[model samples]
Target chain A: MKIRELLTRWVGFVALGIRRTALRATHTARQRIRFSGLGVAVAIALLVMVTGLSVGLATSTTVYDDDIDYWIVPDSESPESPLVATDSPQFSSVHETNDRITAIDGVESSTPVLAQVLRVGTNESDEYVLIIGVINSPALEDVSGLNTDSLTPHDPYYGDGEYNGTWTGDAVLSEGTAELLAVTTNDSVTIAGNRSFTVTDIESQSSDVGNVPTALVQLSELQHVTGATTYDQADQFVVSTSSPAVRDDLEGIYPQSSVQSRGEMTASSTRNSDMALALAATALTVALVIGTLFVVTTSGLELVADRQQLAVLSAMGISVGSQIRLVGAQTLVLTGLGGIVGAVCGIGGIRLINAVAVRTITTEPIAVVSPWFVPYGTGVGLFVGLLSLPFLVVVTRRVTGGKLG
Target chain B: MAGSVASFDEASSSVVVSATDVTKRYTRGTEPGVLGRLLGRQSPPTVCAVDSASLEVRTEEIVGLAGPSGSGKSTLLHLLAGLERPTDGTVTFRGTDLASLSRRERTRHRLEHIGIVFQQFHLLDSLSARANVALPLVETGVGKRERRRRATDLLERVGLGDRITHRPRELSGGEQQRVAIARALITDPELVIADEPTGELDTEAGRTVLQEFERVAENRAVVLASHDRETLELCDRLLRLRDGSVVDQSPPGGSQ
Candidate 1:
């Protein structure tokens, strides 16, 4: 209770102090158009814009998965074995590489992932899609970055035609494609070359924007529709290792394939963060240099003009530090208010940008809301405020120096 | 009746202020100006504003220090008030040597014991008459309610009861000086120092202010430095100064 009372008193004093400063400031009316207030506002606006974009990009593109350590793809030079070299060079089978890689001692498990481009259609509409051939194991299904919660057999492709229990001629459509085709859980669908299928599941669009509404089909069914000669041919292999230390050991086993660790992917994300930080720093520097100068210079001149009044206050027992605090607090309050306004503007500006651009691709415009941006903007304003301290102390002492008579 | 008057002298034995050969030199550098630098006047040209000045005030004596503008009258009052340090001599207050005390000590002593009224009526413009009158007591740590009560009574005594809430700018010069007098006496200091306090008022207003000073000196010793002959006439004793030296004057109400 005592602590509560003390805190209450402290808050009251600060409020009174701020009010006094504001009222006193109005007495010096011609001082209203001070350049320092303008500088703080500009600094805050710039800080919000740069930090907001960086933070938004950081959150939007983040990937969270813990399943496979690396995905191995055939190197362009491998070019053989009758596996078509698509985006990643494909090889004949994962079993051929698995035995050689297992000899290296750290290889935990490796499986082939055959991927192909196909077109799927409902009676109402059709969309181009990427087909991933499922290896028919619960462990393979357990991989993250793949939404399994919505992968039911009653999605839009489940009806309008019969489907065999072996999942052959059966397909799945992601949530986006379902929305696009206005299709439901009992709908029937046809895939590449008019092979009919039932709608099984709709995955979440958040996993990957480019892969939204893409199909996941049985390996046999996928190979039949694409007319591939062998089901064992793989475009890539999802490799899981015992530890990060064994990545290089496995990369050596498949000399014809390129190996990349999850760390590399995480590193790419970190580079984006660093780039954002650098841009923010540059913008903050520019704002501070220009804005702080304006605030300091104007506040200094204002102090000089109020010398007599300040001396009067000092002689009446107000300390020099109190005088400086008064001025600093006054400036910070003004700048902080301006910063809040700037944040409002920044939010509006982001909405404007997304509206003008995002409507062409997606109906939903990006609303840049990030918790970290608030402090980032306030910190910029506070930095400019702290920069005004030295000027406050020097100018206060110079004005009130022992001359109240 | 004459024997009762003799007994009153014993009652007036309390020493309110005492100074001995107090000297204060102000180099033009100390005057806070750039001319001191251009002329190589690093120190204030070493002119003694108060040179070897000595005076004392008893409990109820109204002593007047009469001098021209630069004749060390105001500086001597400042020294007695402990507002400034004497360069060469000692001012002892109630058996304690004031020169030996720290700045904070001197400030405390001034706040508790000595009151000052400036020529310009140095009242805080932001404060009302009652607040200005209570200011010295406030600094002395008096309770707000008591300080206001005493300040209001004192304001009434100074003939400004109606103007208790009026700020300094709203009051006439004489009324402002009266308010300053009330402020000085609010802390009930032993000595009150007035520096040409009536200089800004007209003759009638000046006489009225001097009357208030006389009334205040009945309990506390009033040390006033003024060039006004009428003020000197009203004082218990007058000491003249010229060129930083005290000149002895005739007794009270002399033709000279």
Candidate 2:
């Protein structure tokens, strides 16, 4: 007779669903559903981890300074498929070649850079840092987002082209390095096999280098200490120039190397970034497929074993439509709960992976988690649950046979 | 047979369910495909599970179906309860033809009018005794408080008040059957069809369960299918079925 009463009567199926689903599963049925959910959680957690890593690789391909316009990297492989190798081709006579490039028109500055994961503290402690070798010049003020002008500049350690030069031992530590060693500016710390360097500045690194433990040291000093002074070997060279014609000269400096201007670098990086996202999407699809199949098999077996209970329900005058509603409600509850748990687990996993990468590689993160990853992972879980509905329908039909005893 | 047949025309408002010339036939084996038949495979045989048998059950009467295993007693009861359709003839509940209704309509018709009890109990392992009793009313859209209160009271009436929270696995065979009976009666259905209610119980448990059924029959008509001799002694009238046919019908304590 009343609007509210009519509305309540129309929504009676909701009451039926709540009363029959996992919220009121029998002890035995609950055990079955919980195991199914745990399996989905593990699959979803793995998907989240792989996707996070893929995103990290895409967004964090750079370890050079934010302002560097060109990079001369060894072109041993195609630039499109560049792989970060621990040991690779380098430029001999990099200092002289960089000096020539610096003389060209529109060239503001040029510097040779060498990056190695070398131990920083004493042998008793195990702390490795990304020791970057660069010429600290006023014209080029930053390397990997840390102030480099505080360090000694220009050939101070390459006196007479011999190993007997005055070593300033002045180093600029990234914020992460300062916190790792518990040191401040003006404090002396052991590095590169017990050679003590005074901390000149501790600057917070830019987003380009991520949260790596980094330090900027003079180029020739790093080369002399690391026994790489034979050909002035460096990993790569960063050049600052405004003229597009300057790239051709930089390319000719090393015939076997390749030059990537700012625009070209961003395009290549974008391609790599797109590939990474594609990889993450594939992993997510795989996780969802595996999760769906597992739930179907397990839930099918459970329904087969509990057919008699379904028979009982059918005999009690409950319609097949009502039974379906109850089963669908149960599946949603199980997967929804698993998704929440898996997202939480995935968040923890991302942090753990990033921490390990920082400790070992110390330059670029291997995985990064975003705020949206939680809801995304949960959505994946629900999608997996929805995928298993056809199997569930078949099982429901088989159990609720036409003839009731 | 004394007091065996009731005239169909004599049926009135007191008649809850009447099966006239009802028969149920089931195929015995799977049919061979054409290739199998070419290889000398035989055709599947058909077995008549229930012959053309007429019966009228009035409200408040305890009608017992007595037969040995594999007889038509259970099949006849199934037809009367609208649990299965008859191969021939008509089964009408409260003057409505059950065969005319769709599967969903038939189910609803059964739900609103009839209660059923199985030999194996068929209790849900996940639900407690009280929840099992309250299950049928959930589809009826009864309020939670009312369902709980009614289920609790019914469990107490069935002598399972203390076992209300216990799951079916935790209860004894007689206790579980009593819970099932309580589940059936919870909706206050007009007709109760019980198939071998004591088939899985011991002598003592069976007697206790039979006593509960006796009390259940006080409020509704009971069509009980069982082979046990003493179970039939509690019935007002007995129908003896042999080889899918009702051979004779008589009052209890009389020769079949």
Candidate 3:
């Protein structure tokens, strides 16, 4: 009963406060409230967008990393040479090394994928494409679904039974590469010094960067045509595991090579996108600071101006605490409501920025704007709330002076 | 009802306010300079706002406290209302010493038992007449429906039924003062203090306000401070002040 009564009283007070004031309390500075509310809203919305984008980016990379348990790279690796140099003969052969790592415990599946930046010319332009070599089996089948009915890697132009030992018959093209080359299944493409192979299936790869066309061939055939010494001699190895524990097993097996986890690779790929994070932080900080200052100054100044009225209320049974609440509640409602609205606009603003800037990052054709933006919006609103408190406390205490009739 | 406060001394069950030897002093100037302090000067010149004055009021009486401006009429009221601490005396209300009560206690007491109407009306400009009248119940934790009901009833009785939803600015002076009266009586406090309640109203409005005050004093004791003859005429007894001291105490309806 007491609780019910308290709620009722607070409701009445809130109603009174809201009705008496304009957007804020009569004691609150109007311009300050308007601008502060706007600022808080904007800041909150932007904060939500930034956090969502960051978390999404992290989640996408984490998914990729979790899929690939191990990476095998040359020991002396750097930005200059992502792969072992072509002239290095000993580095040119790695089939025995592949076999050695495949036999390890918890090795669910292993495939030798040769990734090289081979420039291909399309009707419109020429660009570099990554190529991989796969050993057709149930293990590689589980992760990539490359040899299954879904991708249809075994049809004509893709492969024949005898070509497992050779790269002569056909090859598979990655979805992106096939789209770029404007080629269909059964199309033929020349490769590796005049050797031609039929395009059997269009494959999709998580590792392939956006818009890059990829070529896949049987390892032995690629080694034969390109004059590569061994089946694993070409690019990097793609390893899939049923669980994360095999990552350590693969690392222990291939101790001499460097392994790039999915996270590290994606981070490296999206390094240029860090500007988004920085911009978000700066926007939130600027909005919160400016909004807080606007609200506090306006609220504080208005209370000072109406000191006499406050004194009268104080003298007429209005407690100092309730008086403070009366003022604080007004600030909260105005700014909090403003925050919700501003966050919505902030999201639209972000989309606008993205549309104008014209950058290709995600696989989607255009920007993916998140619809719900409460996390950032609430953050901005909370900051505004804190800012309004000091002014509220000071003003109420000063005016009431702990006096009553 | 008139001349009822003379029985304040003998009444054991109905005493509302009791102040004994209340004294308050202001210190001399203490400005930001060495010479001012060297001359024994403070920021403000030392003066007595209220000397040792002991007075009491009983239930169902209206006691008029008349004094010149700055003669501590307001100070003595503040002291009796538990708004200020006496430098050298004690004030008791209903057997509870005002000096002994905590801040919260005093506040609660003021909210539940004392109704004060000031000269300026002090109506919250944002609130309508009904909401303004319901404020004391906010402290009492009453439900909104009940509070509004009581407030509407009070406002209607005060001849403001048509203006219940109008804010203070929308109402005339008489209507606003009526709202103030409604606010003061909402809690049905035992003691009602009116400090120059009608000082700001026109003569007719002032008279109407006094009649409303008279209606409130039917059950509770009213301690009214005013120099206005009309306000004193409504009081049950007159306690006149000269130089911060009570100069005369006349019976109800008596000539000064």
Q: Residue A343, candidate 3: how far off, in angstroms?
A: 0.6
- Candidate 1 stretches with Cα past 4 Å from truth are A1-19, A28-42, A53-272, A281-401, B1-13, B29-44, B122-186, B201-215, B227-234, B249-256
Please write out the lDDT profile of model 3 over residues A1-405, one tens digit for every residue.
378777776776776666555623343256655665675666576665564454334332221223456665545434344344554312334455556666776776665555444555434555555444545444555323234323233222223223344344456776666766777888776554356667877766543222234576665555555555432364556676666676666655443555666545444433434654565566567777877876777667767777777777666667777788788777777777677787777667656654453344432112224544654575577668777788778877876743333
DockQ for candidate 1, please give it: 0.08
- Identify the runs in model 3 with alpha carbons over 4 angstroms from their true place: A1-32, A45-293, A358-368, A386-391, A402-405, B1-12, B28-44, B251-256
Q: Return the TM-scores of chain A for each candidate in numbered order.
A: 0.50, 0.56, 0.51
Query: What's the best-to-worst order under lDDT?
Result: 2, 3, 1
Question: Candidate 2 or 3, higher DockQ?
Answer: 3
lDDT of 1 by residue, B1-256 (tens): 9999888766545777788888888765455368766877554467888878787788788898887888988778878877678998888886578889876577667767777777888775646798778755544445567778999999999899999988787899999999988987887888888888888999999989988988888777888888888878878888888888777754457534
A1-405: candidate 1 lDDT, tens digit per residue: 256543443443344346544544454242463345555676677666665555444433332235677766566555553356455446664445544654566656555556666677777777766566544333344322444333432222212222233444544565656676667665787777467777666655432223223556654466556654343455666666668777777667555766766545443433547776576567678867766776777767767876865654443343455556556776677666556655666666655655664445542233343444566666667677688778777878777635535
TM-score, prediction 2:
0.69
Note each model's CA RMSD in angstroms.
11.9, 10.9, 8.7
| Model 2 residue A394 lDDT score | 79
* Full-model lDDT, candidate 1: 0.65
For candidate 1, the per-residue lDDT at A48 reads 68
Mind listing the fnat for each candidate? 0.00, 0.57, 0.56
The residue-level lDDT of candidate 1 at B246 comes to 78
Expressed between 0 and 1, the share of native interface contacts present in candidate 1 is 0.00
Give the C-alpha miss distance for residue B246 in model 1, angstroms. 2.2
Q: How many clashes (backbone atoms < 3 Å, residues ≥3 apart in a chain or on different chains) does model 3 have?
A: 12
CAPRI-style docking class of model 3 based on DockQ: acceptable
